[model samples]
Target: MSEFVRLDPHVIDEIVAICDTTLDELRSARRITDFLAIGHNFGDFESSKQLAAGYARKGAGTPESARERVEQFIEALTQLRDAFASGGEAFLDAQFDWTRQLQNIDIDA
Candidate 1:
């Protein structure tokens, strides 16, 4: 087998940090999508409380703060939806930003 390449501990730590940050951003985006989907599903219900309760029951976490969770969920979904809906131009813009961040990490690494 070929010998493994080794990196310094500090360098490894930095690289791991960069990866962690990127993954966090990705997960945030996915959570937003989930919340938005849930909101959409609740649209046809006639009662707000009942709908909220349903969401609370089905969601991964208990709605300790119902209003806040709903608001955060809706907000995240809106941001993701808006970003994608801005067409190819916006898509490129978002990619450019993420790429720039990645580039910086590479430079640092």
Candidate 2:
């Protein structure tokens, strides 16, 4: 036997709305990461230069930095939102098709 699954459109809409709000907040947070990049100091002591470089590495200079991580999160969330929206549309289309098929059945034939 085949299993049937049902999803409430209202729930999907709510989830999509939540994702939108979260994405916006994350984008704003991502902008803050730009301020984490510390510039090099040529007129300072060697220790100061080292410290600045260290801070940069831990902040936004490296590929594995916080800024990059935030960008990855944003991408993942966007994909999730797209998936849910598309899935909801597909579900409605399938429901319509099923209803049409059921209405066309000719039991007397």
Candidate 3:
């Protein structure tokens, strides 16, 4: 698990931008890992791995390594957002169940 350090909103936005970037854009002649450092200490490694596996199963253009790091980045950013939205304890309490809730939500309604 990562330390409980609350990042600034601007920093979160920057991290999210990295996650939203495509693999090619992320690499830009460098390694994808370079842009993913912000998420390395955000914890939830298992969830990140699972999300990466899903991305791999989809046969996206990105390589597994890139996808894994990107997934971790995205998930970590999401967790941070949740923590910011609610209190930290509330976010932690519901963290593991969040995906299920999101999947079941009726966004079109």
Candidate 4:
């Protein structure tokens, strides 16, 4: 699961940009600036499950990996929170196509 536990900082920035949200709303969502804040600390299955469902209801997506699914779940939830803070799903679903493409990037370092 640790293979992809953290929300890439660039993704967070893209989330805000693609979503085109105001700073206040993003901050109001929880002032999230780190990976440990929302999803990583959720601590249990049911809690995370509910979190995933909320994300899916919003324009955010569900990733394909199960073991690392929690990371995707949390990232989407954070997006949902920020989006909901500013407006009612103001961004189009197309905004997240970049997310779907992330798996193809060359991350071998």
Candidate 5:
């Protein structure tokens, strides 16, 4: 026999709220990456230009860059928030169904 583990709806709400707050913070922080771009020809020397180009490429030049990674994290957090909210609703519905079922039972019979 399998036992059902009950989830507290309030806790779920708290988790969702935390996710929302974290997502907001991450989104704000992601803006900082916008300034990571460096000019390809940052100096008169060839080495300086190479260094700047490398930094810019790793920072925000391509689709698979540092900024993209931060965006991925934000996307993951958004999904987590949505999942928690959905789970909370499902838990509430299940609780209501269980209560209705118990109320319908005639213990004396």
Candidate 6:
């Protein structure tokens, strides 16, 4: 026999929104990191090519490991939200800052 757990539909929606927002933050972080790494103001062809290559070389994170971590976090949050019937969604929202988190990161360090 197999065991199954059920989650609230609304919680599922919140989870999806959180995942989407998190992915967007990750992408913005990557763009900012790539720009900082390149450190060029000009839009010349060579500079553009170098910037693209730099991004490829300095990937945001290793694909498999990054994916696993993201999935784990989402799963954990899903469980917590399901367990906390009161103010769970609000708590999740409070923890995630779609834009402010990116601005707060200190890439220069």
How many steric overlaps are in each model, in order? Answer: 0, 0, 0, 0, 0, 0
lDDT of 2 at 55: 62
What are the per-residue Cα lDDT tens digits for candidate 1 across 17-71? 5645554665666466356226555656569657755665545454333343444
lDDT of 6 by residue, 4-55 (tens): 3445878766766775666566555545644434535546689787885555
Q: How many backbone clashes does candidate 5 have?
A: 0
User: Superposing all C-alpha atoms, what RMSD in Å does each candidate have to the true structure?
Assistant: 15.4, 15.8, 16.0, 16.5, 15.6, 10.2
lDDT of 3: 0.49
Q: Which 10 consecutive positions of candidate 3 have the poorest summed lDDT?
A: 55-64
Q: Report how far residue 81 has shifted in candidate 3, in Å.
A: 1.2
Ten contiguous residues minimizing lDDT sum, candidate 4: 59-68
lDDT of 4 at 40: 40
The TM-score obtained by model 6 is 0.36
Instruction: Tell me the spans in candidate 5 whose CA falls farther than 4 Å from its real position.
Output: 1-6, 40-42, 89-109
lDDT of 5 by residue, 22-86 (tens): 98888777787766675644787988878877777767756667776667667655655665577
What is candidate 2's lDDT per residue for 1-109, written digit by digit as tens? 1334445878778888998999999899888877656555433888878777766776675556777666766766676666566645444445454455444443332
Candidate ranking (TM-score, best to worst): 2, 5, 6, 1, 3, 4
Worst 10 residues of 6 by lDDT: 62-71
Instruction: Write down the TM-score for model 2.
Output: 0.63
Residue pairs in collision within model 3? none
> Considering only N, C-alpha and C atoms within 3 Å, which residue pairs clash in candidate 1?
none
